[model samples]
Target: MIFVNILISFIVIIILQLLGMVILSKMTPFNDMEELNKGNVAVGLVFGGQFLGTAIILGVAAYTNSSIWYMALWFAVGYVCLLLSYWIFDWLTPGIKLSDQLKDGNKAVALLLACVYIGIGFAVSSLII
Candidate 1:
């Protein structure tokens, strides 16, 4: 029962994070996955930033002052794990220079990437948790 509860809760977190990324992507002017995949710095930063942001949100939610918070805590745990996955991906994907472009002030690309990062983190975390 405990494992089932954890699994369901983790799945919920992944879905919510994906939903959030989709919404965030739509809000931005640019929506090019190809461009985003081409090592755009903006995308990388957003990817990294969104995970960090989601982790914090989840962390706070874990405090469990309310039903919403309790649910959020489960998501938070999954998200942190997801963030670790990102670090692993970065370490593994050597020579992928997205950081340079991010420093060049590219908002559209960044927003797009933020979505991807969060999406990946959410997915990975959901699976493991």
Candidate 2:
């Protein structure tokens, strides 16, 4: 029963996070998937942003009165959430423009993309916990 609860909770959190990311992507002006697939430095920034965002949010969730099951489940769900966010972004903005910008080493655009991912990730994680 405990394992089942953990799995269900994890799935719920992942779905919620994915939904949040979709909403965020529409609101943001940047997309990171284009750069990531093209093997650019922007990928590093995106990863960094995602890592920090997930760490802080999951860390906080792990704290407080959350059970061990909740913490572990949230952490696992967060990773799936991140990937879903990227997939959703690609689907929503299928144009090649973002890739073009990254190819030219546009730091501003890269930063914007990273910020969006981190912001959304953090926001969704907080809501779940």
lDDT of 2 by residue, 14-115 (tens): 664455445534533656455456766765565567666666556666554347567556656765676676666656767635545555666765676677
Task: Compute the lDDT for candidate 2.
Answer: 0.61
**Backbone clashes, candidate 1:** 5
Clashing pairs in 1: 41-102, 42-110, 46-114, 47-114, 62-73
By lDDT, the best candidate is: 2
Identify the runs in model 1 with alpha carbons over 4 angstroms from their true place. 63-129
Candidate 1 — worst ten consecutive residues by lDDT sum?
Answer: 59-68
Error of 2 at 88 (Å): 1.5
Give the per-residue lDDT of model 1 (tens digit) for 18-112.
75566545533555354467765665567556755575455445434335456565565555554554455546657633343354547664565
In terms of TM-score, the best-performing candidate is 2
lDDT of each: 0.55, 0.61
